[model samples]
Target chain A: MKNAYLNFAQMITGIMVAVLLFIHIAVQKLGVILSFLGFKISDPLAFNSMMERARQGLWAGIYICLLAFGLFHALNGLRNILLETGLSPAKMRTLTWLIIIFGLIFFALGTYVPLVLLTT
Target chain B: MADNRPRENSLGIAGWVWAGNYTLERYLYLLHRVTGLGLILFGIFHLTATTIFRVQGEAVWNATMEFLNNPVFMVGEFLVVTAFAFHALNGLRLILQELGFTLGKPVPPIYPFKDAIRRKRLWTLVTLAAVMVLVVFFFIDFAAGGPG
Candidate 1:
């Protein structure tokens, strides 16, 4: 059961990573187009305003979801890597728990981060 | 370079220096580490800039904008974007492996232990194609003078 849960988590993380890659590529290409059109959107005011609206958009929500998936995925991956090393089972279990806790904390921070930035 | 003879067959500690083993798992692991570090560096820069913008107001923000507009900074942005793209794509591969999403294994298979990892190479090719497309776009942006 534990193994199954771990596998499921890993898979979800993998899929999210794949999708996020595509989004990143598409966004950068869009940036190139915007730049070519002489629409310099890097200044704080313009960039912030644009991102603010995007942040409130459905896509932004999707990004936040990816952030959560990525945080957990990386943490879990790290845990697995360590486990494959020479660590003892008890230590591995403890480390795994710690990693999970850290993942949760980071996930919370990820969501709070953009909102906090947008606000203050 | 006379005494720098290559070690035959035996992979010493430094063998993993440029990504130790060439195994699938090792490749993914190294890529993950590279991307993770890249993103973390960018994240720090991002948050630090935001903090400065909040505290120091427009003067600092304007200076930052000027600095970021420099060609060197623009190149750095290109690298960061590439790092992000690679990390995200490779991350998906790791997720698929972890999930046991083999090619032919249907959910609740009669023969559960069938080797479903058949199209592994195909998935890798797809990822490579995606990365190549991004690199092309990145070059175009860099050539046309990238973001500030």
Candidate 2:
């Protein structure tokens, strides 16, 4: 893709990740704060709690979306950083391909856990 | 293939750090890039550890989680929260500016230039305040650690 389109996607995915991550962090990390504010909750990081969340299809969908957006935004940002290092075109292409492959493998691994939990 | 481009102008990765005594925006630019790389590294580690441990079933996964309950990991988690707070807000500012939403009409080049910094000072302050608020929240939540 052209740089313009890539940047546009980066911006869009950034916004999406920000929104989705707010949800993820609030649920996973701020359980104590939420409970303090009168929400009935427990240790969200506990195995049972995490498994319960993973069992839900909605949670799986959210996790999948977060994973996709987060991975792209992150890896692309890394690419941009590396590109600014005055790399040659051939080197840049190689780095881009490497980043894409790494992202794909990470995404496949990440998606599996939630999918398995939701399906099983 | 020896590609000899003019390298004098290119600061390369060094430009991202210790280039000069830059303005607030420039400093934020450095912070943005650094925090971005940091977050990506953290994501890689977190994903790999969780994936490897998780595929082994609940006992193994729980054991890994137990391992992460140490003070070192707790500190790392807190840092992630702090970094996310800064990166997200600064990124919002960057998005708005890049989209030309925050910038007014282009005035002719004149003396006593009212630069973009002046135009964006409000946004910069707002972003910083928001980040500070989030850091405070993270500090509290970290101390509490899920239902304290």
Candidate 3:
């Protein structure tokens, strides 16, 4: 049952990451592509401008959703890799909990900064 | 020999690479694992850096960006792009396989193991080619000092 749940989570998160990452990269590159075409999009490298854009409704939502999916996908993928190393069942359980805690901490940090930046 | 049994001593790093006969499929699996690990590491650094921008203010964020402008860091960024290309493309392939989009329907258990590459070789090649193109594009863009 645990293995089944893990596989299901991996499949779902993997799909989410694949789709969201493409969108994220495309948006990042769109700034450059527009500049090359002489349309004068906002400077992609300008941190302030980027943050300002992130504060907007659509970009902010995209960023937050990306963060949520990315954190879960990455940490879960890492945990799967570690499990392949043939740890004892007890060790596996401990590792699972450790990764879960680590994911929560980092997810909190990741989500907090984006929300704060978006609001303020 | 298509063996499903897990090898007891195949848990080591060298074992992972050397234990199995080298094949395109094995190489793809290895590359996927390595690139996934690389992306995870880079993601950690990125998250921390972005969080620093919020917590430490503009001056520190600018300083961090300046520090990242070093040539060595630029090379690292290139590698990160390469990893991203492979990881993302192969991840798409994996997701497709999981959802039963590409691999053909199940067959009788005469052999009990079907080669995925044989079943979806076209997709494997297409994803690999796509990754190569993207990695080359990113490399050129980075070399030209474009925003990553």
On DockQ, the leading prediction is 2
- For model 1, residues A17-83, the per-residue Cα lDDT tens digits are 6577456444544456665677655522344543554456464576567677766666766665565
Q: Give the runs in model 3 whose Cα sits over 4 Å from its true position.
A: A29-31, A34-40, B1-11, B104-116
Evaluated on chain B only, candidate 2 has a TM-score of 0.84
lDDT of 3 by residue, A19-78 (tens): 777776655544455467675655554677777776887876776777778888888888
Give the better candidate number (1 or 2) by lDDT: 2
Error of 1 at A84 (Å): 2.8
Candidate 1 has a DockQ of 0.16
lDDT of 2 by residue, B1-148 (tens): 6654335436666665667877889989989988998999899898887667876777987888888888898998889989998999999999999988888878986987888888788889999999999888878878876531
For model 1 the local lDDT of residue B5 reads 21
The numbered model that scores best in lDDT is: 2
On lDDT, the stronger of 1 and 3 is 3
Q: What TM-score does chain B get in every candidate?
A: 0.70, 0.84, 0.80
Instruction: Chain A only: give the TM-score of model 1.
Output: 0.71
Best-to-worst TM-score order: 2, 3, 1
Candidate 3 residue pairs that clash: none
Tens digits of per-residue lDDT for model 3 on B1-148? Answer: 5533234565488865766567776788888888888888988898888786655777887788888778898888778778877888887888787778996777775766667667787888999999989877666667666664
